[model samples]
Target: MKTAADIIIELIEKFDVHDAGSRRAHGKGEHHKARVELNEAGKDIFGEVENAVVRLSNAATNDKVPDWLVNIKGCSVRFNHPLRPIDIIGINFPYFPFDSAAETLDVLYRIHFYLEDKSAGRFMDIFRAGGLYRDLGKILKWMPKSTDMDHLYYTAHSYGGEHYKMKLDYHPGNDRIEIYAEKDEHLIDYHPGPAVHLGSILINPHSTGKEVKYFDVLNAPPGMPPNGNLPLLRHYVYKRSFLRRMEEKLLDGKDLRMLEEVWAEEKYFVLSKSQRIYDEIRELVKKGTDMSATRFRELLDEAYALKYEEKHLRNYLQHVWGHFKDEADESEKAHYTRLSEHPDPEAVNTFIHDLAIKYKEPYILRTTMVKTRGRS
Candidate 1:
C-alpha cells in the first residue's frame, strides 16, 4: 500500500542530511559551501531513489549499502556495485572535455541515456577538464604482479608514471597513455604458423599466438566487475595491431577467422517475484527525467511487491531484451505462465544456486587430438 512518496520518505530518512550542513561550515564564505548544499540536496533525492529500489525488491536489508550512494571524491557516485573482486580495480583514462553547449548536451545525453548516474556525470566533468597527477607517489602505488616479472598493476592515479617505462620506446612523453608496466621486447612477434602471431595462418585452441577479446564497458552483467581499461588504450594496443596483421594476411590471400572465440554461455539467477524490482529502476532510467524523484520511487515500491530482489535483475533484463525478443513463442510463454501459477520458489532458488556454481567454474580446454602431421 506504500506509495512512491512513502518509499522516498523512508530512504531519505536513512541519510543524515545535516551532515552536509556541518561539512559546509569548513568552507567558510567560499562557494564550496554552496556546492556542499547542492550535493546534500542531491543526496536526499538519491535516498528516495534508493528506497524505491529496496521496496521494489521486497527483500531484507543488506549490510553493504547500494553502490549509488557511495560518493567518490565527494563527486561522482558509482553507477552500481562491482560484480567481482577484479571489477573493483579501476584504470585512469582521459575523457573528452565538455566545453561547448553541444559538447555539454552530448555528455549529458550519454550519461542520462547510457551511463545512468548523475554522480558519474560530475566526476566525468572534473577529470575531463585536463587534470594531472603532479606528485605521483602521494596518490598511486605501482606493485608488480610478481617480483620476478616486470609486470605491474597500479593502485592509484597519482603514481601512474610507474607504467611509463614499458612504453618509453614506442610511445614516449605522454606517461598516462600506456601505463601497465611490462617488458615489451617481443611486441612484434605476431605472424604465421602454429605459433600464435598477429598474421598467423590458422588459430585454434592449440595455437600459441596472442589472442584478443574486447570486453563491453557498459553492457557487462551486473555481478561482473566494472570497466576499468580505457577503450582508446584497448584500440591502440590490440585493434590497431590486429588490423595491421589482418591486412597483411588478406594481401597474402589467407582466410580470416575469429582469433579468440567466446563460447556462448547462459548464466542464471533465482529470485522471488518480489526481487525483480530492479526492472522498474532500469526502465525508469530509459525514460527522460520527466518524473520528479517522488514519482519514480512510487513505481519502485509497486515493482518490489511482485518479485523478491535478487542479485541478477540487470542480467535478467539484458538477456530478455537481447535474446528473448524473437524467442517469445508459445512454449516460452507457457513456461513463464506455469511459473506464475505454481510459483516454485525452491526450484528457482536451486536453479540460480546451480547457475552461480556453473558461472564460477572456469573453462578448461582438453585436447583430444594433436596434429602430429608436422611441417608442410
Candidate 2:
C-alpha cells in the first residue's frame, strides 16, 4: 500500500503543474500581510495573533489562464504565531467536492486522465468507483466561469478535529455576520458534523496595496491537513526538485552562480536575504548611526523566529526522508524528463513576473497591511 505522501508524489510528477519553479499549482497569486485582531469567536480558537500573511490565488494550474476562466479560487491566511504560524486554507465553494482526503486524491487522478482521454466510459468509471458519484459529477459540471471572486463565499476545509469551519462571507448584501460562541451542528461537504461559523475576513481599511511575494501553506497548524492535493504539496516536491536540480547543476559544472540563482528561489532563500539585511543593520548600529532601536529590536526578534522555524522544518523533513524516499526517485525522474523536453520553459517565469503586474484590482487581490493593536 502506498502512503498518502507517495500518492501525492506520483500526482506531483505526472502533472505538468509541479514542473513550475516555486508553487506546484495556483502559481498565479497575490500576497499580503495584515494585522488581525481576533473577535471573541476567533480568540477562542486562536488566542491572539498580531500579524498574518495572506495569499489570494486564481485556481489556476499554470499562469496562462486568465481570471474567471476557472470557477474555483483560493485564499490562504497564515497567522503570524510569533513562533510558528498556521495557514487557514479556503476555497470559493462552501464544501469540498470530494468526501475525504483519500477519495479527493483518487478522484483528482481519475479526473486528470479523463480530461486528457475524454472517454465517456472512463468518466463514469469515477462515479462507479466512488460512493458520492453525484457530488463528483456535479463538481465536473460546476461553473466553468467566474468573473468575480469578491461575492463568492470562500469556504475553509482544513479541519482535522476542530469544531469550526470558516467562510469568507461577502455573500450578497450586508453578508458579514458576527460569529457567536455557538457551534452550528450542520451537514457540510455531505457529512453531518458540528461546526462553527468562523466570522468573515475583512480587509484592513488603513493599509491597502502593500507588496507581498507569496504565501506558504507549510506553516499550517500541527496535525492539520493542508489539503490532500495540490496548491501546497509543492513544499515537499520543491525540496525534491531543488535537490535534483542542484545535482544536475554540479554535474554540468557550469556557472556556479547558477547555483545561487537556483537556491535563491528555494525555502531558505528568504532567511539568507533577511540575514543580509540584518547584517547591514547591525553594522549601522555599530557605527552609532541614529536609528529607531525599537524597530531594530523587532527586526531581530522576527529574524530569530524565522530561524527557529527554518530549523524546525529541516529537522522534521530529515526525520521523514526515509518514509518519503520510496517514491522520491520516480518523481524526480518524471520532472527531470520534463525539464529536458518542456518547450515552454518560460511559463514559470511568466507566472511569477505576472504576480506583481496582473493582480492589481482590489477584487482580485486586496490591499491589506494593518498593524492591529487590540482585539475588537
Best-matching candidate per lDDT = 2
lDDT (10s digit) by residue, model 1, range 26-73: 111111000111133323222111110000010112223332332111
True-vs-predicted CA distance for residue 51, candidate 2, Å: 1.8
User: Candidate 2 lDDT, tens digit per residue, 172-284?
Assistant: 24322222222222323523244454444444433334423334434444333334343233343433333333332322223233332322333222232254544544553
| Residue 149 displacement (Å), model 1 | 23
Estimate TM-scores for all models.
0.23, 0.50
Worst 10 residues of 2 by lDDT: 367-376
Q: Which ranges in model 1 have alpha carbons more than 4 Å from their true place?
A: 1-287, 305-341, 345-376
Q: Give each model's whole-structure lDDT.
A: 0.24, 0.43
Q: Count clashing pairs, candidate 2.
A: 1
